[model samples]
Target chain A: MRTYLDCYPCFLNQALRAARIATDDEAKIKRVLDEVGMMLKEIPLDSTPPESGRLIYRKISEITENIDPYRKIKKESTEKALSLYPYLKSRVVASNDRLLMAIRIAIAGNVIDFGANWGFDWDTEVADTLEKEFALFDYDKFREKLDTAQKIVYLGDNAGECVFDKILIEEMKKPVVYVVRGAPIINDATRADAVQAGIDKVATIVSSGTDAPGTILDTCSTEFKALFHNSDFIISKGQGNYEALSHTSASRLIFFLLKVKCRVLARNIGVEEGGIVIQAGRDR
Target chain B: MRTYLDCYPCFLNQALRAARIATDDEAKIKRVLDEVGMMLKEIPLDSTPPESGRLIYRKISEITENIDPYRKIKKESTEKALSLYPYLKSRVVASNDRLLMAIRIAIAGNVIDFGANWGFDWDTEVADTLEKEFALFDYDKFREKLDTAQKIVYLGDNAGECVFDKILIEEMKKPVVYVVRGAPIINDATRADAVQAGIDKVATIVSSGTDAPGTILDTCSTEFKALFHNSDFIISKGQGNYEALSHTSASRLIFFLLKVKCRVLARNIGVEEGGIVIQAGRDR
Candidate 1:
């Protein structure tokens, strides 16, 4: 979706949050706010939020000299999710509709996001996800697409969320290329993070060739873009990826699995904020 | 309290809100954001939020050519509060402690703030405020000061809130100079607003001689400053006044009556967000 005015303040808030995590130096943090404030003026509202998000995270990294501010947090998140893996698996195995259960678990794990700035309890989120109704469930469409597709490009979101994605991928029982970010931005999963989550064991892991929190096609490598277009079935995860790819004329190949995190995305998807969705991507 | 880093993003958000209220011209609204974004860079952390707030509203006015963007809204708020005035007085009359009930009513009206961006219902807020415990209740201190004080300076806040302040001023039963903003900023009360709220009928309504949302001493006229210094008992209403005067070495004369609306102010005041306070200001 296109950048809204609401996104401007949200961008600055995210910049400050990332900057704080990156460094303790008050001066550097203030510099981040000052520079980011100045930077916001030049940003056009027509561009996708992730297009500007790419610049914001890069700016935070540059000012703080901390390339991966969320490195420690991401590691802890992965470990925490891994510890819950056996239990998560048991739930999926117990469910009559294993694929649907796994999808809910994956969306639940999405609450781990730092960029969304939601203060969520992990246990509560998992329990709530199991019971909470989806705002937009395109399950029949997802099943229909999966039935005909040969290969699936499953885009990964956060580090911990990857473990939940693993359950869904296992249920898919298809040749899946698990797509991660090219580099660290916020808590977005990189190839190393995906591997840490044991995604390598379940599916082939590859970078989307963009370090941005989302897969901005212009920032992606040619090979990754080729794979993205060639794949008949694609799964876009989280608000960032949804934002980056939502405006694309990608037909109906991509199904977005995410919890609506912000007002802009919620309005765009015709869902309330904090509602979960499995939306089918279509031509603009 | 000094301006926190959190205030930067909040300022932008408020700017956007005020801009939208001011005009439908998308270009002008965008201009407000761009200019406010640039302006934020120049603001000093030591300066009060309303010091910068002055410049932000000015920029909006200049960009949109709407000097009093909230003029119509202020009128409606005043009318709404006026409608509630008889009921408010009845509550005060029925109470065993009339002054205390009036104080609660005054604080309840503070929920009328647009700048705080709290989506509050008037009836619910009024009911809640009557029962909500104060985070910092300096009622004993306030009463003691009121017993001896011959003259008072009551710093008024927003338009609808002025009607509530009128009740409190009437309960004071002493000579009161009801201070208001010299010109409009946000929904903050101006001389005209105070008059419309019948503040002149109860107390002598005077302009603080600053158009800023709050009473910044540097921005205040010499007369207002002199009156402020001379008054033995001062009642500062709402967050903006508290924000502006909180840093001053004003002894113990200034009693700040406000609902803690934002995180930064809440943190500074040692209260939780949404708590009410009758805070006694002291020399730093």
Candidate 2:
């Protein structure tokens, strides 16, 4: 979707979050925020919010001189998720409707985002997302699409969340290509991160070859775009992917599995913030 | 308190609130936000958040060409409070401790602010705030200060909250000067709003001779500043007044009767947002 006015402040908030993670220096944080301010002032109203997001994170990396500031945090986050994986897998395994349980776990993992600038306790949020009723559940549609699909592409979001995605990929009976970021950007899973999270064991892993913190089609490599075009079904994860791909006119069957983290995105989708959504992508 | 990193988003949030009030035009709204972005970039790190606030509202007025975007809302808010006045007065009269009830009532009225960008069911918020125990109640000090004071200057915040201030003024035995803004700025009370709220009937009413949406002493008239200086005690109402006057090192004893609104301000005061406070002002 085109950038709404609400996205403007969120851009700054995201910048602040990255700057904070990048350094503890007050002057540096202020300097980065000031730079964010100037960029926000000139951003075109029609551009996608993540397009500007790409700029803000680039600036944060430049000013802090730590291209992958979240590297340590991402490792810690992955370790934390791995520690909980056994219990999570047991819950999914125990459920009579295992496919449905896997979907819920995958969507719950979407909450691992740092780029969204939300602080959440993982266990509570996961339990809440799993137990709470969906605000937009396209379960029957998802099942139907999964039944007929020849090839599937799964988009990955955050570092820790990539591990969680493995459980859902294990449930899928199709050949799955799990797409990760080309490079590090605000805790989004890169090739190194996805491998560390062990996503390589569950699905065919490939890089999107862009560091926009989301799947911006124009920036993706030819190989990734060709895979996207050839895939019969796509599973886009988290709000970043949602923001980037929601406006695409591509007729490929798609499902957006995410927890609504931002108010603007939630409002755009006509749901309250913090609601779980299993939404079918645009068909046109 | 100095502007926090968090205030960057809030600045855009506040700008949105003002632009929405000013007009329905999307282009106009975007223009003001873009302007707020530029202003946020240059705002001093050492200054209070409200210092930049003054610039934002000014830009809103200049771009929208509506001097008082909150004019109709302020009138409606005043009417809403006036409708509840008799019942609220009865509550105060029947209470065992009249001053405490009145103080609660006044702080509750602060929820009526348009500058804070929160939509409220004022009746419910006022009722809730009145019934709820204060997070920071300095009752003994407040009572003792009131008992000892002779000349009193009461600084007002929002237009709707002015009526609630009258209730508190009625409880006080000391002569009071209810100081309002000299002109319109957001939903802040001016002489006209004070008169509309029947504040003139309860106490001496005067303007601060400036519309900064808070008490900026240097920007006020010579007469208001002298009254402010000479007064034995001061009762400052709402977050704007708290923000503008909190840093003052004046010798006059001051009581900040406000609902802590912004996270930045709440952090500065070491309180949670939405808590009612009867804070003692700075002496250093």
Strongest candidate by lDDT: 1
Instruction: Calculate DockQ per candidate and list them.
Output: 0.71, 0.66
What's the alpha carbon RMSD for model 1? 1.6
Docking quality category of candidate 1 according to DockQ thresholds? medium
The C-alpha TM-scores of every prediction are 0.97, 0.94
**Candidate 1 clash figure, as a count:** 0
Error of 2 at B47 (Å): 1.9
Given candidate 1, what's the lDDT at residue B191?
Answer: 86
User: Which ten-residue region of model 2 chain A has the weakest summed lDDT?
Assistant: A245-254
Residue-level lDDT tens digits of model 2 in B1-284? 56788888788888988898899898999899888888877888777666677788999999998988988988998998899899889999999999899898988889997776487777778878988867777779888888988867899889888888889998997788999988888888988899999988888898899768778776799998888888878998887777777877862368888888878788888888888888777585
lDDT string, candidate 1, A1-284, tens digits: 88887888888889888889999998898889889988888889899888899999999999999999999999999999999999999999999999899999899888889996556789988888789999998899999889888989999999999998998999999999999999889999998889999999999998888988898999999999999888889999898899898888873679999988888888888999989999988887
Residue A11 of candidate 2: its Cα lDDT? 84
